[model samples]
Target: MWDYSEKVKEHFFAPRNAGAVDGANAVGDVGSLSCGDALRLTLKVDPESETILDAGFQTFGCGSAIASSSALTEIIKGMNIDAALQVSNQDIADYLDGLPPEKMHCSVMGREALQAAVANYRGEEWVDDHEEGALICKCFAVDAVMIEETIRANDLSTVEEVTNYTKAGGGCSACHEGIEEILMKVMDERGETFDPTAVAGEIKKPTSGLTNLQRMKRIEELLEEIRPNLQRDHGDVELVEVDGKYIYVKMIGACAGCQMASTTLGGIQQHLAEGLGEFIQVLPAEELARRAAMGA
Candidate 1:
């Protein structure tokens, strides 16, 4: 079962600003009942000062979604619209003392609503439609742009993490690969590496008879064998660490910046898995460091 923080429960049970604001001048509507979550945010803005005088919401979803919408209204009640646009989904989660990772999309919806409302007040065009070929998760109507932004905003590294933050791959699993590709692109932009094991979730235990040292030695030998091929192209790979089924390596030289780095990593992973007779995932050294920094 998902654990609900106390603040979340408080807002859910007795949501503040629960109805439409009287004399509301700005309105933003997002999500859909068919998608299982919908929200309508109404704001009363002082046109002269460009300040939000009041805010209210009506939401349709689980407890988390309602609480998130409530929290958003409370958060921006007295703020300027420009300042409110800076409110990220993480800020909403932080306001509620943090949300369950699985429920983060609630906060994301809240953020989007705020942007839409602000745009409405400013008479700016805001389009949230799912363009053809741009939609990434059909089940949730999540698009690639949303997924990419969420990944960058939250430093998301895994397909599961992306699902939790944006609800992109949470249904049917068809968009898992697309989510992973987005993750890789984001990581590459950040000059970090991604671990495919996290995406595929196919880690295997070490072979029955091989000791830890034996496994480590075999992995290093396989990496050594792979190095010469990379070296032929003025690139190289160096083993960094071995933890369970994950073998972390650093790609140096041209390979580090290669557009086909993921493909090269996949080749290395396939080679190691075949040689070791087990499912082994090749990861970039930066992935290990990122996990450490996150205390995960």
Candidate 2:
């Protein structure tokens, strides 16, 4: 039997908003009839608060997608606009407790439908694929604006909080520390104080403890240690950074072109991140490759 998250099991059985709204103020459609997943969301707004008064959805997909859509509706029925907007893919995933790795895409569809609905409400169309600020967080196909806005919300009280608010770090944890940096800057600007605590036992070297050259030397050593196994497979894995509990890496070789590159990067990341903290963020090599490609 496919192992379902307990939260997933509950949502699948008793999805809250399973039908369509009688008179919707805004409607958004995503996915497709032919696509494995499709969603139609009809929403009612609280004119004054811009809050969601009621919402309902119709989904044609696997259990996760269907349940997620149903659950999404229930979540937004009475949430204010800003708060509802703050409801991230992570929040949905958390509400459902957990999801299988392969089926994670299903829950993502629920979030997409919501984005489309909100875009529709604003009378805006989906932007061009190559438009500026359009880096699709490939794992979930979510855009940067979504991440930036999600991060800006004070809801993300700390670095890991973004994982609870957005599934960004929950994927190939590449941007884990980057997201944290963004949040830290935001908090500072708002005169908010966020803890700089590292995950227990994670290597949190003081800023002045290791000079730039020493840090580079340390990373080189770490890479050298893993170079053999990587070369055994005609590959190279480079550790980009070791921050707190997150160990970011870049993989080169068969992995660079492999369809499972993300998977490979995640496996490597998981191994390294675990070396430090019980809770570690492993970033994929693809992110580094992509950045390199862009920089070049």
Which is the leading candidate under lDDT? 1
Q: What lDDT score goes with residue 266 in model 2?
A: 52
- lDDT of candidates 1 onward, in order: 0.82, 0.64
Per-residue lDDT tens digits for candidate 1, residues 1-296, read: 66899999999999999989999999999884324698999999999988999999999888999999999999999998888888888789889987875576788789888888988988987776432236678655577877888889978788876764555676678988888899899999999888877543333655635889888888888888768767754589999988888889999986898766776787788668867878778999999999999998
- Displacement of the residue 19 alpha carbon in candidate 2, Å: 0.8
Pairs clashing within candidate 2? 174-283
Candidate 2: misplaced stretches above 4 Å?
A: 32-35, 128-296
Candidate 2 yields a Cα-based lDDT of: 0.64
TM-score of 1: 0.48
| TM-score to true structure, per model | 0.48, 0.47
Per model, state how many residue pairs clash.
0, 1
Which residues of candidate 1, in runs, are more than 4 Å off? 32-35, 129-296
